[model samples]
Target chain A: MEKEISDPTLTVSGQRGPASHERRIQIIKSAHEHFLQYGYKKTSVADLAKAIGVSSAYIYRFFESKQAIGEAICSVVLGKFVVALHELASSDMSASNRLRKLYITLLDMSLEMFFNERKLHDITIAAVEERWCTTTQYHQTKYEVITKIIQDGRASGEFERKTPLDEVVMAIVETLYPFSHPILLQHPILLEQSEPEVLHQRAIAVSNLVLRSLAP
Target chain B: MEKEISDPTLTVSGQRGPASHERRIQIIKSAHEHFLQYGYKKTSVADLAKAIGVSSAYIYRFFESKQAIGEAICSVVLGKFVVALHELASSDMSASNRLRKLYITLLDMSLEMFFNERKLHDITIAAVEERWCTTTQYHQTKYEVITKIIQDGRASGEFERKTPLDEVVMAIVETLYPFSHPILLQHPILLEQSEPEVLHQRAIAVSNLVLRSLAP
Candidate 1:
């Protein structure tokens, strides 16, 4: 509740005719920046509004609470991840290669945020636990991406068709839990290797296990 | 808290020579029953002593708090799961068969708890989130069982050595997460089938995916 930040109009003074939707995006971005800087539990709505040079009341028009902002941040991050997986899945690489790359990317992104970007990772974990609508959509889309890859793999005669495609895709993600799951990754027994190379090797091994499990 | 329940001598009136440790075991069993009969959050220390015909103070002599009793109950349940896994892992069945049976048992037990024993399922979830020490130990022991099975799989020429055996074991558990995880079992997408037979088929499908992944 900074006195100086109480004026949303003044904050937008430099712009000639900023639309309400554009301002909402600006608010979301500013809140996301605050999250990355201050961590999830510590970042207050007032802090986010002050950082954006807007009044807390002004920010309230856009978001209901800090939890809303946090969900938006996670949606953005996970959206980007799903987009990356879709891109790789749609590429010209062999279906098997695409699936492997998809998991490698997944493992890398999750681990990077977890180990290097601790604040952001904590926020993401909170969002996940809350199971926001966006998180559900992200999982749904992720399932489709894996499903598409399996469909392609089946068409190419690369993967065995012994199980239903949906089940196989689900099993692949579920089995690779140790390599990509952030919470499970935190367990000392699953994560003795701190070196990125060692961990990457583990991810690769896991990806290979998935690939081989589906081989024709 | 009841005056008469605190009378330890009266609680064990007929016992000529009761060891303190043995009494502790009896207290754990009584608390476990109360937990099953009345969910963890509702089951109080006084209620436990009342059920056991002992004083609340006497219950404290054998246990620290209600949380400790809850944890002990979880420990006993998870210990049984680990033992079941170990027995299958050590049996004369082929390592592939053993692994498949292991996951089948896991999925069945988890789903059974979720669907048939709602109170116990809630208690399990609480203990999991609480990260009880025994839960940690259970995970450690479960990992060993998977590792042993993987080793036997390799020895039996059923699995290849593409990944470190440790990583492979972790991958198998991670990948089969949906079929075996209680929380995931509650998801509509994963548990569309209410019939145990249908769910068992899904577990088998997942188990085969893992088995195929490790095939030479």
Candidate 2:
């Protein structure tokens, strides 16, 4: 949380001209597709360039490295989830209900990636493993949203005001780690038997504990 | 929790004769040493055989595969922590205090493996990724211990009895995932900044939230 995490999507680096911007977006789109088709590790810069009718060097003109492209892709993919969290936090509902929905939504998104978007999940695993800035940014953004909800809950007299804000936030984040962390979610034990309904139930149960802790 | 998990350490085949038992123990000891020194994946069965002055087939006589050897080692390694958890749960301390110490102890043990036993940490990653029976048994045992403490807390008028026992246990288990799951502990973000004191504080903060939820 001490380090500043810049958004990779905003730093795509091909803003020379409108055409150059278009080319970069085109390259990123093709790269995303290639990553999905052949997986992040299997799809190389050469493959991406060839698929886009460009050279590998041209691909580098946009992305500094394969991992950079991966970072860009992850930013876009994880950005949606962050936006969802923001919307959920800002929703017109009780802070407690919003908190419950937030975790359940987080679980649903993660399960989606694990079940339907396997290749994207692979990229996410790599991103998390490699400690991509995007992943750090995502977590920081999540922390901020959770902090906002806790503040709102306190303001609305729905949650306890005695516990330190940082402590409560850290505790809630740690509680959600298994659902939010890709590696833990993909662990054989969870992945093997994670029927969506069962995971939802677990998420609700965990959220209830968080709510109970926050009760005034 | 449905599958019955047999103890790998208790099933260390070759209980034929006293010398045979001695030889089996020697093989496991050498393998554990080699794995610690060279790494689990890098130390092959043949390498272990050469290190122990025995044939690979001889090693296989007592173990089915290299993974099986890893499982046995993991069982022995994880078993110690399981014993500590049982002891903590059975202690005369208040159930709430015992629960707090349990997670702190869990965090300490994981940190010890991550910081001091890097090779052993690698073996654990493999065990978790491969879904070894030892890992499953370790989790189940941990779950049962947590359940026991929660039961005691409720009986002693320390914790609420309204929530379903399974729900509370699952919530507590999920809450402790970051501290207990080896892969999450090894994540770059955590490993990079996890000074023991900082981690212990986080553990205490999290345990406090858990106890709040359980309060009568």
Candidate 3:
């Protein structure tokens, strides 16, 4: 791995903040709920500060704006995904099974977060669509995980990839797009069928497809 | 094998239009350009009518709303894809080669439409996000094409799909998604890399992944 990515839940530097990192985490936790309920645009900094029992000035010391707070919340969510993915990567399973589990878990997590706190999903969509650094960093993390798995799969002789490693990773990521993207989860209207179970089934099938394509 | 989808470009009943079907097609052709120029929301009936040298009421006689006009444009664009796909499918190529060509052409068409007429891509995204019947019907057409190709592949002993044919088809579409979807095209910012050539390369890589997965 080029750059080791460890869990940074406690270490992610606040974009700009009051001295206490814990205080920033507290603010994010409070703001996440309000943002989800009211959406990114409707949620106000003054209101979030009030809910967090901090003055609006204090909130500003932690976040530049409502959108910034939403972005921080996004980083926290992505951080959690990374942490979970780490555990999945270390699990004692075949490379293909591990990859399959990673996608299933990733999609399920997105769907859960989307339905449970859609505001986060909405904010995440904006973060992604705007190519916000938070989303980009998360995707970078995902890319590394995929490359590592593909490398291990090749080393174990579990798969033979005809393309360059980066290209193969791109192929797998694009292949799993519909099954894993948060955008797809939020926009069931975009799919031919919106049933949750059906999407899950498709996710599994796609994993198998990728794994089959890689058989050595 | 089921649900015959053929050239209905000349036959779709206008939402509320003048008696002449040809006139409806003419109105759609005109509105398509305006929709591409000014976006779905900005372009108005009056502007479209003026551009076509007709009264706003006449425009309404051929289409119910600016959105309806947008939907018709989507239908027309989708109709063209189906026609082109038929030609490709009927060509004497291996099933994998034919499937590859279908996605390559579909994505290139989206890119061309996006760059040439961004407003149309914008409107098509709305129609898709809003689940307009035009977009859904196009998907249905795509589904049929996929089934036909897969069936041909199986009969020729090119594939041994372990899953149900629908599941296999879902895998293929999901795999081709980032390459073929209009929403993905318009939101280049959402992707990790937005360089057109890189996206095209990824599209080819994903097609090979699908074809390899299906090999008997």
Candidate 4:
């Protein structure tokens, strides 16, 4: 087994200067593009380094290996997903309305990622299957965040208390996970329909079903 | 692409007698074992032939290639699933009772397939991703069988009329698909716990939720 290490250059501390931050973002964006086009199995460190105009040794300074970089990309995407849900949690809307908005936002984000950021989805799936510990912890954190929001809704008398918060959160995540991952939608059977309008309607329908189930 | 030809040997026509039927079933069983051990990508025609105590040329006499054998295995499994649902549809139980039984049956069948017939699950996942036109048609046929059961319930006043049959079908299939497929369960994250009992209970809970929503 290879030792995996996290990227040190891309700090979340918000202490990096603008130039450093911009450079880091540039490398990440380049890597993301390469991974999406070629997939994790085919993408090489040298390829990514060449694309980013850096030596392979210098690329290693930021990430330990291709797998580490892929994990970082997944972390970035999942972090963004958590932030979006948090934003929804902070809103002053009814529980059902917040959930409705959350679903729509998630579906749109997924479509954008599917069309433009497919590599991230592949990395995430690999992380889930291969890097189970990290992926499970990440899911636990996200589940906690969503569970807290549901609990808050119950406290505010905006949602029912009948359903278990954990179950509801898991169900919601399970229902939306397919739409969030491009590999799933990439199925030819699912892609048979060309109308974006119809696909959007299907997402809305699924969202509505979840909301109705959670309704007080 | 190689010329696509349907397996005349697998057809239910009178051309294949009892002995041929028995041989086809034996081939599927042997191929299933090979798939479980090596996955769809790694499993070869020669491997299956060796496992079945036959020459590679003899294997090809019945099926075109390794992929065609996989298709045959999937068809056998799916055919059994269709038969189970058809029997459930004709039962005279109340809607809620029938739904409960259906959920339990699916969970049990999925577990059985996941543990005992892992190769079939592996091939099915490959079939889904490869979008072999035959696999897609097989899925559609399975969906149609389930849809007709739901439709029968609706017409017989056994189920509520307002439920979205397609969405319900998708949700049920999606939820059970991974649980049924051994490859997905082989992930360490899923293997960490006793899943069969918990999953069976969850299936019941989800079915109840759907039935409550659909009840008139």
lDDT tens digits, residue span A1-216, model 1: 001111111111111223448888888787777777887888788888888898998877767788877776666677666677667767888888988787678878877667666667667656556556666666666677788788888888988877777778766656555556555554333344346677676667668777878888
List residue ranges in candidate 4 displaced over 4 A.
A1-27, A44-57, A132-159, A181-199, B1-30, B43-60, B132-194
Where's the lowest-lDDT run of ten residues in candidate 4 chain A? A1-10
Please list the residue runs of candidate 1 whose C-alpha ends up more than 4 Å from where it truly belongs after superposition. Answer: A1-22, A33-57, A60-70, A91-94, A115-133, A151-164, A181-202, B1-22, B33-60, B64-71, B90-95, B115-133, B147-167, B179-202
Sort by DockQ, best first: what order?
Answer: 3, 2, 1, 4
Give one digit per residue, the lDDT tens place, for model 2 in A1-216.
122223323233222334349787887788888888889988888888888899998887777789888887887878878778767877888889989988888888888777766777678888777778778778887887888888888988999999999999988888887787888886655677567787788889999998988889
Candidates ranked by TM-score: 2, 3, 4, 1
Worst 10 residues of 3 chain B by lDDT: B1-10
Candidate 2's C-alpha runs over 4 A off are A1-20, A187-189, B1-20
TM-score of each: 0.67, 0.89, 0.87, 0.73
For this target, which candidate reaches the highest lDDT against the unseen true structure?
A: 2
| Candidate 2 CAPRI-style tier | medium
Tens digits of per-residue lDDT for model 3, B1-216? 232545435233337845458878888887777776677777788988999998999878777777777777776777777777667766788778889888788888777776767667677777777777776667776777788888888888888767588878888877767877776666656444567788788888888888888878
Cα lDDT of model 2 by residue, B1-216, tens digit: 222223323233222334348787788788888888998978788999999999998887778788877777777778878778767867889989999998888988888767776778778888777778677777787788888888888888999999999999988888888787787886655677567777778889899999999878
Whichever of 3 and 4 has more DockQ, that candidate is 3
lDDT of each: 0.67, 0.79, 0.74, 0.61
| Model 3, span A9-114: residue lDDT tens | 5233336855369988788877877776777766678778777788999888877767677667777788777777777766678788889898798888877776
Q: Decide which is better by lDDT, 1 or 4.
A: 1
Q: After superposition, how far is residue B190 of candidate 1 from its true place, in Å?
A: 8.7
